[model samples]
Target: MKSFDIVTLTVNPSVDKSTHFSGLIAEQKIRCKDPLFDAGGGGINVSKAIERLGGSSLAVFTSGGPVGEMLKELVTKEKIDYEVIETETGTRENFIAVDDNTNSQYRFGFDGDVLTDSEVEKLLETISNLKPKFLVASGSLNEGLSSDFYQKVAEIAKTSNSKLIVDTSGQALKKVLETGAYLIKPNVGELAKLVGVERLEIDEVNEAAKKIIADGRAEIVVVSLGPQGAVLVTKNEYEFVPAPNVAKKSTVGAGDSMVGGMVWALSQNRSLKEVIRWGVACGSAATMNEGTQLFKFEDANRLFEWLKNK
Candidate 1:
């Protein structure tokens, strides 16, 4: 066993296709240029962000069909260590359109095909073999898989004595908590949905977080509040980490970058407060880039320093 620092599991990965549009017109031809294709999933993005931040992680997920093959090639090109389990159904494709004139973006997504029970078993077995120090379960569950799919992964992580961090929504997140994950990263909207409440105010954020922690489902609850930064809630602590004010760009992948930063900090034995700083910095840095490309290391470094000094 190589004792990897982090192992990321993505159930539904995709080939993200981003194209630039000059502008939108009613019933008019809109030519798209500067198309960019990259392998994307919450976990895959996190792995890429980790590498960019000088951290090490192994990318483990399932890939199948023709899209799967291309995705495998993409990961290989990025030099990311990965284990791909063959499946019967093809992976998904997510589309993003950027406006060159206004520097804005529009995104469209698709749900992935169902995974057979046997395929799920194979993934569970593969996860057993790797035994990474920490496990990050991100993205959505494929069709036919129970909402508790993340819960099962959490069980595997616990049995292997690995810390588990879950980034999911709705019922899937609810079940995953039953398995006792170490951390959960939910944005404001997601947090509201999980608890069946309206949007959360900064004052109410801690209350919502406390409800989840009271059940002993998760040790740490990170509620990302977009431009307002994030709130960290634990049994005995509640702290709000503010984002360094910066010009806003495309908002894609900012949350995932935060996850990557926090996990990297945890791997280095940094304090939770310090991890929050890194996470906020990464998210702020991500807004500096366009489309799906997230946080540059140089920008993240500067933001981290500024955050620490504040």
Candidate 2:
């Protein structure tokens, strides 16, 4: 298995279409630029981000209908390896349109079609067989799929001795925590909820993360502070890396880029210090790109260097 085969599972994948328009007028027609299509979802974006850093990962996701086929084509175009679980219903499509006059983005998303029991079983089977060194389960679970599905994936990870890195929100994340994970990336707001608090101050971030680790919910907790950068906390070690200021074009995929960077670093056996820095560097670098695109290796490397000194 090459010592560390990284596998990413993205069950509710989407074909993301991004474009720009001048303005939004209720009564008038709006003209938009030609749309750019990209395959999207949590784990898939993570795979794409890893590829940008010159690493490889298997993006295992569910696909159906023409939209699903197009999504696969896009992933192939990126030169990332993948395993698909074909479904009866079509994959969902997400729309992101930017208003040029305001420079604000409006995102509209649709729920993915439900998967049959057999398809769901195939997903679990594929994950079990891969037995990668690191398994990442990101994005939202489908409508009919229970949150306990992640609970099952967590169990599979445990049985396979795979380090599971999760980057999901809401009940799905909660379920993974219950089963325990090697790592999880939750934004500060999500962290607050996990600890049963309304919010957390900057200094309190470490304590909040430590609480989860202390409970064995996760071995390592990475809190995304957005533009403030991110922090990595374990039972005994803590590292905080501040984000370097940059010209950000879009915020899409920044969090996934962070997860991808950290997972790739983990596969390389990089230290936690290096891991967090690489994560912050990749995430911040992702914002410097246009819509639906991730970071370039050079930008991420430069940012990592800057973060290393800090």
Note each model's CA RMSD in angstroms.
1.6, 1.3
TM-score of 2: 0.97
Reference-based TM-score of each model: 0.95, 0.97
- Compared with the true structure, what per-residue lDDT tens digits does model 1 show for residues 1-310? 4668799998899988888988888899999886777888999988987888888899987888888998999888777888888888898989999888887789999988999889899888988878888899998888778898888888899899989998888899988887788999988888887677988777888888888889888889999887778888899988788889988777778888899999999999988888888999998898888777888999999999988855
Best by lDDT: 2
Which residue pairs collide in model 2, if any?
A: none
List candidate 1 segments past 4 Å from native.
none
lDDT per residue (tens digit) for residues 36-60 in model 2: 9999999999999999988999999
lDDT of each: 0.87, 0.93
Superposed by TM-score, candidate 1 places the C-alpha of residue 69 at a distance from the truth, in angstroms, of 2.2
Score residue 55 of candidate 1 by CA lDDT.
88
Clashes of each: 0, 0
